[model samples]
Target: MRAAIANYWWGSSTDNRHIHWMRWGRLTAAKCQGGMGFRNLRHFNVAMLGKQGWRLMSRPESLCARVLKGRYFHDSDFMECTRKKHASHTWRAILAGREVLGQGLIKRIIGDGSLTNIWRDRWLPQHFNGRPITPLADQYVTRVADLITASGQWNEDLVRQVFFLVDAEAILRTPIRGRGDDIWAWELEKHGMYSVRSAYRLLENQRLH
Candidate 1:
């Protein structure tokens, strides 16, 4: 479709020999990079679908997420769900965008930390290796709440024993609010909000790495 649009825009016709000017790659370059700032169709489609994936991740209790989860990922994380051969087109599209969403998102623990599993949940900052703080983290603490004392402060001694000194220090630094539900955030964004634009940028950046 984009090819057809470009052909029409440049007056390329079957009856006449076509003359090429600028390349499509340059036309699709961002405005700041000195191009036309035209949206890349493939990226735009994935970004639009990724918006739906973000909705599923952020609004797990919403009707759409509930229905989709029941149908697709009832026993697994949405990020871990695989595409089924008989799935609907919408489901497939959403799954495609989920790859982008997963790369740039992280979990944020708040208040009681009751909802997070220390070894299983991604409450810590993502490391370059993308693994938990310690290989034997599950052997140390079962849940994030376990790291908290009865008085609601982090268990510094226990943390230092279970994690590396560096990781233990980082864990101690995570703030605990008096009361609030745990939330997830887009690690790449400053405001902790998910946006298709930010997600799309993440996908482009990932390609370089």
Candidate 2:
């Protein structure tokens, strides 16, 4: 398919012979970066597969998501799940796509903060590294819920004391008004939802950089 596409791109439809001015790779680069912006087929496939993996993360309530989770990662989240020796082709393909998710996957703090670890999960949207810059305090907090007050607000005094000033401020700024589960989201999009378009762009940018 690639050969046929390349042939049609630079040569006559009736004949294969033509003067190729640029390589297929350059043609696949972004148009703004001085290339034709053609989609790299392999990268696009991975991005699409990544979308499936992302759905498995974001839509745990869906039938497909639940079934896959039961079969694969019943105890842990998709990101932490490992390969099984008897894993199906579908599972392996989804895992391949999931690999593309990488560090871009971040948890949005929504309802109760039980699922998000205070020291580990990437929940701080404003912070550069996503996780808190605060050093772990001794046994005072483990989950994000520990940092929340009884009124569902941040434990202001504890937050200020336990975290560095920077992290304290970031934590204080995070809104936890919604009564939903803490869920994983793609950090690249404003709505925090994953799309093949965004995934493809992310994959392409990674290739370029």
Number of the top candidate by lDDT? 2
| lDDT by residue (tens digit), candidate 2, 65-183 | 99999999999888889989999999999999876786567777787798898777888885877888766656578899898876788889998878889998999998896787888
At residue 124, give the lDDT of candidate 2: 88
RMSD of each: 3.0, 2.5
> Candidate 1 regions off by >4 Å?
8-17, 31-35, 125-133
Candidate 2's error at 159, in angstroms?
A: 2.0
Question: What TM-score fits each model?
Answer: 0.79, 0.85
Worst 10 residues of 2 by lDDT: 11-20
> How many residue pairs clash in model 2?
0
Clashing pairs in 2: none
lDDT tens string, model 1, 115-148? Answer: 7767655666655422356777248477788888
lDDT of each: 0.76, 0.84
